[model samples]
Target: MAEIAVLGAQGQLGRQFLAVLGRRARGLGRAELDLGDADAIERTLRRLRPQVVINAAAFNDVDGAELRRQQALAVNAEGPAELARLARTLGYRLVHFSTDYVFGGDRLRRPRRESDAPAPVNFYGYSKLLGEEAVLGAGAAALVVRVAHLYGGPSWSAGRANLVERFLARARAGQPLVITRGQTLNPTSVRDLVPAVLALLRRRSAGLYHLTGSGPCAAAEFAREACRHAGLCAKIQWISRDPRPARRARYTPLANQRWSQEGLPPMPHWRSSLAEYLLSAQNLPIRD
Candidate 1:
């Protein structure tokens, strides 16, 4: 049994991590543990004393981050830095999650690698990249994982609706679902991500890795696929321009070269995982 402690335990990814850990782990939700509060985190860590601490908490509002840069930096950058410091001092392995927005490749087709130089275009991405640097710079045995567009399963209590659910809702209502066509990303399912994360943890791997679905797809394509998988009539409208304040990358498909190099099997493609998620009992809409 692995002694693991999951921060952001109620999040989509965090919930999946706990399910994988089962009785061997303890979870710390927002009320239980605030990443912004370094003293609180230290006290909780001292109490749990888990061998591995997974920091899944983040200020994930991409557009909102443009409005609240300080808050985003506090949670996304400073908090992780403190956690890394604690992990180093307390002798625990730290596993942190990052985003694909760290790269400035809007026109590039190839997926970004762990060794690629990070040049974030938005405040949110910059903050996440900073967090990753903080963890590694702290000199802790840390694994910094950068994942692509993520959607989760039935058991997720992420405190907000997922992309699939939001799309399904708009589709079922016969509403015109507008998705960005200009941006291309690999949509990774939490179903597949949990196992990949577990494999990395089992190896107790350190440094950076990219974990995402295999294919690069546009958001509109993803919406159409989700609607098709759910057997819903969708009126998906494609939009090349996003009016949002945050500057999103046009192409950010991540390649799991490091994961493969580490001898782990490749993850399923986005379509394959989307079909499985759409067919889940919780994801299905009630029939008239």
Candidate 2:
């Protein structure tokens, strides 16, 4: 087992990485490894020095990011930049996860590619975009995997309210579930994601890759599928993306031709991934 160091190991997405990597990897949460402390991050990376560092950390609250611009920039932008720089210096391969928000949704028809121009609509997007630039600029042996609509965490991730979790809770409570029929994304599940990320590191495929689920779907369609999978009967209320106060990418679905060019298999459809996600969530051991 190649020793891998995972920053933000306690976070929802970070924990998914831990689960996939298991006990073979050294998992460091914020307490154990602080991103704000560059010296600490570098010192630890150099001394314990894992072969690969997977950065799942990000300041991702879209609305909250608008209110706290500096905070978002620090974590989403500066932190990854610092880590990637340190990784290059210390000779550790870096696998950094970025987001779809990097692209502003002006051209919904044209699927955003690795080369598409990024025009972030909000502070969160801007910060994440900055992080992407930072990592790429570091010019380390890196694989920047961009994904969207993520679900499956070590924790239930109630606060984030990912598609499956939101729909399941609503159906369980018999609450009306209204989703944005206007906004679109290919839901990328953690199960499929973690494996692909690990595989990428092995291949040493260094560049930007659009690793989303097989295709795109509106939020409403995702909700309906979630309801069906979870065996819940809730009246799905459909709404447009415009009704939401936040400015989101209207239709910036990513194209996956890069995956083909790299000769990697297409990720399983969102529906298949979601079914597995729901099953695993249900079978989770009871937490204290």
Off by over 4 Å in 1: 154-158
Across residues 1-288, which tens digit of lDDT does each residue of candidate 1 receive? 348899988888888888778988888899999888888989988888889998888999999999998899989999999889988889999999999989976766788888778899999999999999999899998999999777975433545878788888788788988777776788989889888887888888888999998888887888888887877777967777777899877888888999888777879988889988777787665543
Would you list the C-alpha lDDT of every candidate in the order shown?
Answer: 0.85, 0.78
- TM-score of model number 1: 0.94
User: How do the residues 1-288 of candidate 2 rate in per-residue lDDT, one tens digit apiece?
Assistant: 448988878777788888778876888787877776777777778787788888887776888898888888888878888888887788888888888888886655766888888888878888888888888889888888888878876456534666677677777777888765566778888878889888888787887888888878777778787777666775877666555445787676778768877788988988888778767755442222
List TM-score per model, in order: 0.94, 0.91
Locate the minimum summed-lDDT window of 10 residues in model 2: 279-288
Query: By summed lDDT, which 10 consecutive residues of candidate 1 come out lowest?
Result: 152-161
Best by TM-score: 1
